[model samples]
Target: MAEVKQDQVPQTVGFLEVILTGPRMSGFAGPAWPRTCTIYVAIADEVVAWQTLPFESDSDDFKKWRLGIRVPVASNWPDLSLDIFVERADFLFRRRTNMVVVTREGPHTSGHTAVISRARLRLLDALVLGDMDDEEEEKTMKRRRSEVMEGNPRLLEGTVPFGKAVKLQDWELPAPGDEHGSPRAVVRGRVDVRMNLRPAAFFG
Candidate 1:
């Protein structure tokens, strides 16, 4: 096998964790549903990640999931985190990012959408944990996991890079038993893009 250099890739890769408020009837202003809603994170027509939210009556725990997003060099914009409804970032062709795929009468329908942006990455240092706190040796591995991302590009963001410039080894990473590559940043936000999810397309 050949070791591929991160620099030659045209897309940005990232791991995402989204905290959903609920299976609401509408937007954040909508009433929360007692059950769960299947959510997806996508770029262009590619559905990169998806999760069926779990409902809990015991606590106010919102749905959290970690997925990946790929941003091509074409749509590589610094302000990808801005709300999709904005005039500048506005997208009318089948709402993408942080969405719930469902069936509708026609290809056209009205809906609300929000994407989280400028989120802080939760730099995970195992030595920082209580179990691994006792280890005094040099940190072996390190990983960067995005926080609960909300808002809308479904608030999808990734490590900085433009055209094969992402070198994970050169990125900020250090910790034994920890692996790091192109650390990702995340936040708390929500998006509402309704569509249908066919598992065969993504899973196949």
Candidate 2:
């Protein structure tokens, strides 16, 4: 193979990607589990993604169903938030949590009673380019003053925990409960994801 120059590598501007790297769900194979498994995550619009998983697992890893979503910026797109959640099973009840809301000003993971820190909001706003230059190409460097993340696309670089701790900018994500360490934890499993802009080497 011929050596490829840096300029030949591919890249993207105004991109939002989420990866379900390794999902370890805990449940019995009985009917108690949800009749269906659906990921109600809001991308450009309401997400209609559903998944069927084995209620019981013999191994510690349930990554058989991995996901990679890339949300692109379009002039006509209206929605500004990316909502993520799991549907409730018959035996399960609802729990209050913050909803990620985005707008021309900024993004925030907000709930009725509480709101996420401003620092965290900046992390999610990594790719929300309100006025991205339509003339610019993906491979070319961005020069717009409103460009998100000076250089990087502001994606969670490495395998980060998707549990209680939420830090997308920092790949580590402070896995205090690295192994389901939460004392009151009912669901016993781990989720490590790698959501990046993705280097061109990966496509190669």
Best by lDDT: 2
Candidate 1 per-residue C-alpha lDDT over 1-204 given as tens digits, one digit per residue, 9 for 90 to 100:
988898766553332222223332222422332232344544333455555443342345443322333333222332232111110111234456755544332222234332222111112211122112223321321221122122113222432111111111112234455665444442222333211111122322
Model 2 clash pairs are none
Tens-digit per-residue lDDT, 8-96, candidate 2: 65443334455654444333432222333343445544573444433444433342556667655333222355444444332223355
TM-score of each: 0.24, 0.36
Best by TM-score: 2
The weakest ten consecutive residues by lDDT in model 2 span 112-121
TM-score of 2: 0.36
TM-score of 1: 0.24
Cα error, residue 202 of model 1, in Å, equals 29
Query: Global CA lDDT of candidate 2, please?
Result: 0.36
Q: Ten residues in a row with the worst lDDT in model 1?
A: 161-170
